[model samples]
Target: MSIVKEFKHVNYLWEDSVAAKLAGDEVALLIYRSNLLGADLRLTNYGGGNTSCKTIEKDPITGGKTEVMWIKGSGGDIGTLKRSGLAGLYVDRLRSLENVYKGIEQEDEMVELFNHCIFDLKSKAPSIDTPLHGFLPFKHIDHLHPDAAISIAAAKDGRKITQELFKGTIGWVDWQKPGFDLGLQLKQCLAENPGIRGIMLGSHGLFTWGDTAYDCYINSLEIIEASAEYLDQNYGKKGPVFGGQHIESLDANGRKRQAAAIAPVLRGFCSSERHMIGHFTDDARVLEFINSKDLDRLAPMGTSCPDHFLRTKISPLVLELEANANLADIDDLKEKLTPAFEAYRHMYKAYYDNCKHENSPAIRDSNPVVVLYPGVGMFTFSKDKQTARVAAEFYTNAINVMKGAEAVSEYTSLPRQEAFDIEYWLLEEAKLSRQPKPKPLSGRIALITGSAGGIGKATAKRFIDEGGVVVINDNDSNRLESARTEFNTQFGKDAFAAVLLDVTDSEKIVNAYNEAALAFGGVDIIVNCAGLSISKPIEDHTEKDWDILYDVLVKGQFLVTQKGLEVMRKQALGGDVINIVSKNALVSGPNNAGYGSAKAAQLHLSRLNAAELGGDGIRVNVVNPDAVISDSKIWESGWAEGRAKAYGVTVAELPAYYAKRTLLNKIILPDDIANACFVLVGGLLNKSTGNVLNVDGGVAMAFVR
Candidate 1:
């Protein structure tokens, strides 16, 4: 594939002549170039590369010109980079520190020195590679870990191959752990070879620089394209291939079902008490790699690059799957997979024990982050869906790089000791330390039905606030999209996903549950909050009204709960199921026979499920809320007027009328129900099941015994 250069897009940034006339023209250009590099996954994986431009800016306090390096900041992707993501450091101060940190040995101390050179006190911490950028005297610098370059850079004779391909156009540096000393080495290399246009660091990545952002970007593209051309010339025809001989019997749906069965067992094995989500892909290249005869020898050869060790473990776990395995029986699948996982853990522990040093931090979990199953292809696990996707993408790139290298010569990896050092590097650990403390449900996934508005929306938001990923399902497509946009704006784009589903339709419910499982590893919490209130006397209630109420409140809850049970059972991870019932379920209300009776049936169904699922450690509970008239969709459907008439009060006075009747004289809000749902599903009521939590401001008649 050719590199994409949209020069017109770059020119448009300066078109607002007024904004460009003021300041930050260079910074804006750097941001645009960085985003362009980040946009191509082949050029850089998520948050994997750094870029910088050297410019002069006047100090706010001193009113004197100062040379500064505007470099990409930590913990943000270059694709969506903004002004805030670029850390500006005083170049003179950073360059002068070359001698000050000359003999410092600790990694943390070098990082401290790097932070001290920040020109803006409020700016984010500069990238760990800032020194390498600062040491170079170029007007602009770009460092990328492109897969094509990595295939060439990570080989046994990487330096020789790079020199042969670029022919003095690029310089080479042997692999050294990145820090102050490596920065010094980079400077010396440039001083020794002044005519080279770029530097290719052994087993690491490539560095290119020029006088302008456009020049540097083009230089990077050219170098990478040259490497790609070399790979094509050598092994273009004999690339890795996958055949369908083994799975010729199964259709696409059958293959997906097989993966669904196997994914949960793998996810449960990888996860500890803290949940982890798994993503699976059987892409042609991945399948070819897994099904190869030499997989056993090639899989454990270490990561494609050093940075990948941070996301994927040092190596992937290679598990063998039978050619025509029967995955319909979960017990049989678990039986076959359990021993393999155990062995993998033992092997990982041994690897860590042999390489650990005195200063090394505690060994990370022994579970493999990436798992390769012969028939299932690759599965990547992480605390969240986005991170899992990132891991999967990097591993896929690694496979391509290895294939290219293997086509030329044997694939080589860093020594185990060096891999361990980079894996435990302080800079990598610091990124994790910078995050806030995780909430109780941080990595769990929740599925909330009827989430377009009212109690369901509130509950979905609450789950997201607690760091849990959510799936919001509603039959109304437009309302669901609107709610999804709002949630995405308030929380994050990946915080929740929206599915258009009518819960009463069994087929739709099944598809929605499957969608949730595919998006996340599996569902850990199910909140049954989809319902419509019908305020009519028993004599006035029609057969159609009865069917609708029963279908939504009773049958819908039954179908959703059953689907949730199937996922929980397959995952073998304990989960929570919460039914949003009503106060009328306990105490009969006038003109509310249809709604109240259906709710009562739902409450009973939850109790029965609690008793049955307790053996599997799944907790089933119910929340009974009273008179949540304000901001409720049930009220919008004429329930407000009906309830107001029943209470002999106007619609505006209904809330106060119900509030005065309660012992606490408080109006029940949607948030109150949401809080109760959180308590049940967030593990606060872990030991209690089949219990009803009251959220009605202490109603005298509706209080649970």
Candidate 2:
């Protein structure tokens, strides 16, 4: 039952070879072992665990050897840990400050002392659990909130049961907010129980240590494996099955469609003044937990551990759908679910009022981070997709822990006061407080058409960089896929979604909007950037060329804008729409009848939408850009050379020729146009609508009055 010995992927010899070359071999080994532990989701979720190694580092300046503990730094996850992610603190200095803890009445001051003990001033702040690692005599330590361990740790009489299962190989500590006091308690417990190899903190997690990283890691694996084995022998088959006659009628895709249909409504209801993006998951386990009969009794008990409180509020919102309600009718579902969310908010306010201390920060927005719908699985919501995903992961793990514990006896979590204390603890809050200020459109979602390259791509990147989630759309599948990969790589995998479709097709446009809604709850801004250019004299222009230009330029803008308006209305949040028209709309030119007329009409359509949607708080605007032909697809389709020939310049000199003609004498880049889009959509021009912001490098002929 030793999982580490049985793990076939890890090569101890290779790890030793790599660690042998490092000056701080213990630190190097710690990093390698931390990564291995992080690779398994069963061992850690996101950045939930910490690891440390005690070693002696000779001071470069003083040439004196000093004991040091290199622990995983705050905000660093072991999965991506590097040398920089581990903070090196002088253990002697930290132990010397033990007297300082007596006078430290506030937890924040103790945290300050922890930072003060760092040997390298430039190193990241040490993990808050540094004292625990430093006080232990072991050379290596690993602490994780593994699901299997928590199943035993969160059970009723958990300490007694864990003692029975481990047979005194592990010591138990009562749940305490992780701080100087808890660290001292752990050190005292280990001193009293000299033979214990590991310790389980009731209602929290486990800590294992040994003289070597391999020993510590293997001990953790064995402890976890033993916990799993115990649970399997005692309660594996006692839990209720997930699906029965209730969900048998619907197939997998049908259930997914139901979840997709209801996610936006749930998002809208859960969101406060600012919108929240919903991440939907119906993984078999999630479905089982949501569909379980004991959901009402078990779901409200709170997070399995205090670490999850910040991400997924103390408890999830459990909603029971009407037995005969229609899932396909979104409006009807919204009507039925609105009161449940309102009641959840009311209950949360009451809980905060009763449990919060006077020094506690103001109550957070009362919207639930996790929502449980009987037949529709679960929906986790947050300001962005990444946090939502993390919440969903932790909640899924919580379900496993709860089912295992329930099967044994009854699952018990930390009391509500303890959960609230950790949630609002100043030390815990300080971790997030260190983040930089958010951008203007931090929580907003935008859908930009033609985002594969040029102005559309630039605009999408700008939105993402400024803390907005964007759904990139384009008719070019290859380019769209490439752009998606590039954006996801630069930002995060959850930052962007790509939909390949023609904006001119009404049916496809509607489906694309639906796809965007499902991906990021709903759209907050819409950028109509899909278009082409055709240069032909009025007499030479054929009907086919005119139709093609009109369909893509004007009709495309109309269809996309209309669909965006519908989504915005459903969300009941004010939105912005930026139509990427051309300078030809403001100023006419010969041999530009097809392109110019269509753009001019598109500009008019924006004005009409602005007029109609003003009362709904939807701002409609147009960005008129010119001479951005260098990387645009329109130029690659033969329009660039033809336009250069008409202007009496070579294709290479076309950009300069247009630049010199403008009053500013500057080459207008796609990024410049993207900046204008940001200003209009990012609330800088909140009070203005039905207006055209020109990014044409100050074209005198195209200046609007």
Q: Lowest summed lDDT over 10 consecutive residues: which window, candidate 2?
A: 241-250
Tell me which residue pairs clash in candidate 1. none
lDDT of 1 by residue, 1-705 (tens): 123454311121222343344345788878877887888877878988789998998987699999999998877788888999888999998998866674637645777777778888767788778888999999889888887888888877788888888998899998887777778888999999988999988778889998877678788877887887787777735444321123332445655666666677777888854689777777777776777766777788876577676788889988767635777788887888888888888887787789887877777788888988775668898988788888888888888777767765667877888888788776677777888887878879899999888899999989888879899978888889999889978987667778898988988887787777666777889999998987877798899999999999999999999988888888888899999998888997799888888988998999999999999999999999998875677887878888888889998898899999989999988889999999887766789999999999888787778
**Compared with the true structure, what per-residue lDDT tens digits does model 2 show for residues 1-705?**
212255332222225455456535788889988988888878878888899998888976689998888999988898779999989888988887777776436655777888778887768887778887888878999989888888888888688888899899899998887877778878999998998999998878999998877788888788888887777677546535422224422456665666655666777777765678878777777777777666777778887687676788978998777423576665776787788888988988888888988788878789899987766677899978888888999998888788668767678877888888888786777776888877787878899999889999999999988889998978988998889888878987898888987987988887787777667777889999998887766787889999999999888888888877777877777889999999999887767888888989999999999999999899999999998975688987767776877787899999889999998999998899899999997766899999998999889889888
lDDT of each: 0.81, 0.81
Error of 1 at 134 (Å): 1.6
Q: What TM-score does model 2 achieve against the real structure? A: 0.94
TM-scores, one per candidate: 0.92, 0.94
Which segments of candidate 2 are over 4 A away from where they belong? 1-4, 7-24, 59-62, 103-108, 239-249, 322-331
